[model samples]
Target: MTDLLPLWRDLLLGGFILLAYTTEAMTGFGSIVIALSLGALILPIDDVQTVLVPLNICMTGFLSWRHRNHIDWRLLGRLIMPFMLAGTVLGYWVQPVLGGALLKVGFALLVLWFVLRELRRAARGHVAAPKSGWWSRGIVLGAGVTHGLFASGGPLLVYGLAGLSLDKARFRATLILVWFSLNSLLTLLYLNQGRLQPLAPHVLAYLPLIPLGIVLGERLHHRVDEVTFRLWIYRVLAVSASALLLASLLQLG
Candidate 1:
């Protein structure tokens, strides 16, 4: 293990780190999106995963606490534990095999596929939303696996929740809990596998950013209307995801 404080690794990278958490705090998502995209731009893919995985633990943990009560654990049992448990192990195993570039590419594709599918359904007025059920186990399991794989499970989940008749805060809050918990668990699992590295100094550099961003996001979220917020989030997911995928693919080529 080596630590190199290269000249290029400065406050801009640190600012990029804050963007993720701030986005998350505001919208209940975007930390992973910001981290993965910005990290890929400067750090190697492997380094990105190792570095940001820990940061994910912190950001998600905070959000989880904020949204703790919103999570429906009875419904959570239907989807989270069994679903992610398997996916968690898979995430650890897949990292070594796919390496960094492939993981980025894979996440991009998954995000795109889900987002566009949601868009198409919305266009056709087929967006019906998520209904709580034992019947929805298949979707929940599949969503868990996707979350396990990329932590970008938001595309599948966010859209799914939108289709449900849930209130705005409840939808976003539950997502915060789900993602924060699952990402934390995956990080622990990855550490056990020795794929995740400890990045204390790295995390410390941007630690202040998460809280700052969350505060700002909360401000923005309160100011915006629900319908407008959802629309903007979808747009962000589509555009941010497209940009990340294109950049990674270009790098690969």
Candidate 2:
């Protein structure tokens, strides 16, 4: 098992878990990136992921079940999952060969480009029609690769899915199911590699936060209108991309 963290650090991590999972519960994605980014301050990034990925399974699984009726099964099984899974496998295979900094910078730039374009259009009161064809598929594939690399593929996935112009409920529900599937794969990988053993205590301790986050976030989710929700999604994407870029650049420096 990994060495136990100091009590204060553990408490801080719990706080981060609460905040991050709450966001995921409300938005249907972001728990891993948000928690890992914050938790990395107190723990190694790898350790943070080891703990958070499994914890994400709990959050996503419950949300997926709760919102099961709203999922867009056709969109998920036909388009998103297949491309993303292929990219994820490829990404995992090549992870040892590629430099992490380069991949992160590239992914961040890609997300920022899409997000800024969408935000500008939104500002002009122009809603771009849902994207299709190879271009959208490519985005989802790249998102899978990023997920494999850093468990932070959410922004790109969001970007790709936003084009479909799903209503807030379907959008949130479908995305959470995608996360449920992806994170479960990650958890199984971790288990087979024996990574989860060391992090079991942390995982258990953090598990309670999931339901609390769901309760709070579900209430908030009901209040936001569709337009405001979409706007905030882009805003969150912008923030996530910016943070990823800054972190990658800092690491390079």
Candidate 3:
């Protein structure tokens, strides 16, 4: 029983990481949110966060490299990075007190809201983005906080990006750069708090699958057009958001 337990745990962990990273590679975000929400059911949320942060940073860094030329360095430096870092500072402070289960549930609720909002936008045939200004900045900062706390800030950030009217390649590249920078800080924070020690072995075991998922995801990203991409993104978000919300509610019950 003991031997079988570890095998099952590793399998679940590997599967979640593969799926999440693939999504991240294709979309340039969503890996941490997707993986953490699902992985929390199989492993402790804190442990999953610790183990996955480093892996996510590494994966995003790789994707950033792969699409280096497409990154919006100006936007990342001027707005996204600083705002997201600020959010992480606040998120880290409140995380310990909020408790893991509540945090996960809250993140799921947030994602659900974004998914629904995007669906409504899509259905209305609304292509012109809202004007970019303070409101847009607020959205990005809000995404930063959620990201800092739960690592699921992609959907909110996507809303902000939509307003910028970026091309598909720039969108993915910019997201990869933003996550790489933000998650690098998160990894250091995890290390300082000693949250990563126990996860060392699991990290090594899961490392091999990371690149495989990224390669496959990269292929998919290249093939997808702007319209098809948005359609697929929301579809995935709706299903995953619903699943996470359901899982969190079950935990409460």
Maximum-lDDT candidate: 2
**Candidate 1: count of backbone clashes, pairs at least 3 residues apart or interchain:** 4
Worst 10 residues of 3 by lDDT: 98-107
Alpha-carbon lDDT, every model: 0.66, 0.82, 0.80
Q: Which candidate tops TM-score? A: 3
Evaluate model 2: give its lDDT: 0.82
| Model 1 per-residue lDDT tens digits across residues 1-253 | 1355664565656777677676777777767766667766767655565566677677778767777777666645656466655655565566456545666677678777877876677677674656556545545555555565556566655644455655657666767777767777777766776765555567667667767777887888788897677666777688658867876887888
Residues 53-137, model 3: lDDT tens digits: 8888778888888789999889898878878778777777787786455666777777778778878888999774764678778
Among residues 3 or more apart in sequence or in different chains, the pairs in candidate 3 whose N, CA or C atoms overlap within 3 Å are none
Question: What tens-digit string does per-residue lDDT give for candidate 2 at 96-189?
Answer: 6873777778877887898889889999999777667788899899889888877777888887776575888998899898888887888888
How does candidate 1 fare on TM-score? 0.81
RMSD of 1: 3.8
* Candidates sorted by TM-score, best first: 3, 2, 1
- Look at candidate 1 and give me any clashing residue pairs: 22-213, 129-163, 129-164, 130-164
What's the distance in Å from true for residue 197, model 1?
Answer: 4.8
